[model samples]
Target: MSVHAIFLSMLCILLGLAKPSSSATDTFVFGGCSQIKYAPGSPYEYNVNSILSSLVNSASSTSYNNFKISLPGSTKADIVYGLYQCRGDLSNSDCRDCVAHAVSRLGVVCPGSSGGALQFDGCFIKYDNMTFFGVQDKGVVMKKCGPSIGFDSDGMTSRDSLLGYLTAGGQYFRVGGSGNVQGVAQCVQDLSMSQCQDCLAEATLQLKNQCGSAAWGDMFLGKCYARYSSRGDHSRDHDSHDDNDNDDEMQKTLAILIGLIAGVALVIVFLSCLAKLCDRKGFFHISSKEDPHSLKAEIQEDRYIEARERK
Candidate 1:
């Protein structure tokens, strides 16, 4: 293959091998598109793209941000409002990656919709023509309850205590463990503390009432979520641990592949540079019998003779 083609092929392979920040975090929890569709190439479509781009860009710096987009002279219907919020525990880089994934998935899941919402394990994103920011929405968007453990009193007590602790915290994100139960709760940053408390209260209540004696449960409200896992009592925890292990192994394998690809790419670059250098110096057709140093000397002597002849 030509040197340029080889280089391009190597580059494509490198890019294809590159992995995202965290597959577990990028796992799709839920997504929905609006029933209302915007005309393709319409002004509203432009605003939607702009707002989604803003959301992805802003995620690198902050865990939560809201954006409003409206061009001058555009009507209110053409405006777009959007926000993205990453899980509190994620690093800025991870948050950026998660939000980017969510944004890309939004286009696939909610193509041309005037409104959409997507929730991933690590981030949440939503956009619409109407205003929804800072508005309290306690409506349940998702609920999952693990297999029932037939009412272990101690496990139930631990789960209840953890949920209560999650609600008592004033921060937007809370995590706690009680005995064998691990719990986490978070509300959108725009909510006031009281609003967050109310949201979590509703979420935990749902978990308690709907998932009674369950080994694990999740309650996702419009603006908040609460989840708890009872260790050693559920398969979900074990499955998650196995998934993490697999992810680690896959990452290590990818790292080795990247290293190998990068090495090959460097070698190709070096050879290309050397070939260019040789071609520029007129060294492409040196006789096999000639020493390279002697060839260089002969070329210089020929150049000198040519200069003398010209004079």
Candidate 2:
């Protein structure tokens, strides 16, 4: 397959988790375009779409981007409900986008009158035809730690080595926030405090399972993180590095790669390009006035004007 096709296929199949319909009361309805399925004995099989449509519409009406609705159907029980929270630092746009994506996945991952969850890095959405919204269910949580975090480095100090994950209450956090790393927690704002806590705890377990002994990964689906070390926080580290020296490093590496791909000398090409750019106007004017016969002079006054315009 072409690289593009392989990339797309991998993305489509990535969410491998499946909670098969083992429950006598459960029905799994995986979503596909315009496809519909019904629980074996559901008295209101036809109205399932109506129930989902109304709930989604209502959610859109409110600012509840991460909202979900369930229908118990009159013969069964009250529809279960759930919504999740993206990382709190995410803006309104991100929250809305994440929720919408999660909702779409829900139809595919969990269809029909059964219970299921659609998990993502930003959030998780779930529902059953049962009342799960207000209740805190610990049974749903999953956890895994870096069971194989062991590694050895020649120059790195013991303190800088990759370490296994630890819980929030452990000695890992005993230092009480001495670093740039900040602990983050998020939940559907509608969740009760206890419910939020339960959700976060559950998410921690799931992260442990997925990441194994890796030094870092998502703490859980859209809930919270309770490990240690901000230095290993790639998100923050990457963002800060973009400001200056790191940007140059990236540009240099990119220039080299492009040169190789295009069968040209990358460094020489970049330097030549830069030199031409500088020689544009007052590119290398040196003041012979201040220093006797200095090779460099003040930049041509017009070049400053051009630089300002570029900015």
Candidate 3:
């Protein structure tokens, strides 16, 4: 098969493996596409398209809670770096769905952009044209808090204990509850111990300073995220056989059905484009007068322009 055909086949397999789905609690948090734009026919654009499939595949195929992949561009000038991290409480299936949804959503939101990041309640995904691995980004990307319900001593204590446990432990993440208060703290796997500590400290400070006295709060930083809640039994029981869990499963089933339909549609589109290219260049006519190299170059230009137009 041709390179394009291989890419399409790989995409189909990855989409199937991802089994894109959503649950009652799974919701889009926030994300931003980079401002840097690539020209219609630039190598950077090609690299982005080529590597996106691999990134999504890597993210969904892993049983581990976190996944990261980096692919060099066709040339040395550009590369694609990507990573996905699921919350500590999520199941592997749920994690795959979140990551798949994130990959698709971020691609649409930032079409042809050089970089982007998307965060959901259960997972986070990010990609860029440069090497961002092992780097600690302390910047605050987002912060949100529930309505103030005044101060609760138990909540504050639990939150402190959560952070304290994370600081003392060697793990990159911690989740637990004390009394009626529940909290979670996590740092990306790429961070060093010291870097993770610094990020958690900054995140904790932001959670306190920005979300004062709120019943529930979440702070997303460059390399870490912290959350706490004091609003009625916030602890999650992943193994519970309850009505809410059933509803969540139903939602996931529907989401998976929709994703499969979308995947089929994408395959149709890709095949159509391939057919047109083949016909336009007389691919079956080896003795045709047209130069194969020129036709391929034209096809590349066409794809780039189409991508830009869609954006």
Candidate 4:
């Protein structure tokens, strides 16, 4: 194998998607005909069912829809059928825009192809000559941006630390990860946990191949994103909701004591870590802790693995 291939394979091991068993196909794709257009004849040229058209453009930041084409006079399919899905986390508006771009661009790039899917950072859309719901497909195209920087020689250990943290569902974590390499993983919604892990694993490997040794990098796909950055964030503010809820609040500090304690390092460290996590990708906040109705993206599969196992 080439260097890129070797690096990619190694990365896959790190992310936990190296080799997964393919299970028998047991997937279902539902609803797709409302927003589409079609013909009115007995022999359809794959007309979009009214049901499908209505549903295709209906993803409310967390769903998928179907699209189709038909002959001018036929009622039966003579041409094509397909489905689309935006990332489960995107707002409906974002999903709609992404689909419009993806579909229009797909025509320019691969005209007449009956089946394919396009994924943007926030959405994914797939169509095929044959039905494609619930079928496991690694054939979707994926891309990654180069890492922004490099790792310390100590970087490899941190990388492994993150990998272990994710794969073992945080079992191998050391809580005092005060300053460690930053890493994140995500997978499509429909996948089983194992399948999601497998997808993450593949994406991790792809990153290694594409951005070897770079400091900041990401594996981007139609369905998910896995990324890492080298900037050690040790001082982040955490008490956003209640300014008085500081961990240091218990310390009896006369105004003078507070002034005297201004240079303390622990306060800085706690603040930094807290600030970095709340707003970043890969991290998930519990619903009750944060506003449940707030419009945040869906937490990825890997993030849920630990919570799921704990239950």
- CA lDDT of each prediction against the hidden true structure: 0.87, 0.44, 0.72, 0.48
lDDT of 2 by residue, 202-300 (tens): 655554456544443434333334433345442323233444575566557655654454443445567767877887866765544666433233445
Tens digit per residue, CA lDDT, model 3, 28-77: 77889889887777777766665556555655555233333334435665
Candidate 4 local lDDT, residue 20: 30
TM-score winner between candidates 1 and 4: 1
lDDT of 4 at 287: 44
lDDT of 4 by residue, 249-268 (tens): 43333333434344344466
Give the TM-score of each candidate: 0.71, 0.42, 0.63, 0.45
Model 4 — TM-score against the truth?
0.45
Q: Which stretches of candidate 4 lie over 4 Å from their true place?
A: 1-56, 65-81, 143-151, 163-184, 220-225, 231-311
Q: After superposition, how far is residue 258 of candidate 1 from its true place, in Å?
A: 19
Residue runs of model 2 more than 4 Å from their true location after superposition = 1-37, 40-84, 144-182, 188-190, 198-214, 217-311
Rank the models by TM-score, top first: 1, 3, 4, 2
Model 1: weakest 10-residue lDDT segment is: 232-241
Count clashing residue pairs per candidate. Answer: 0, 21, 0, 36
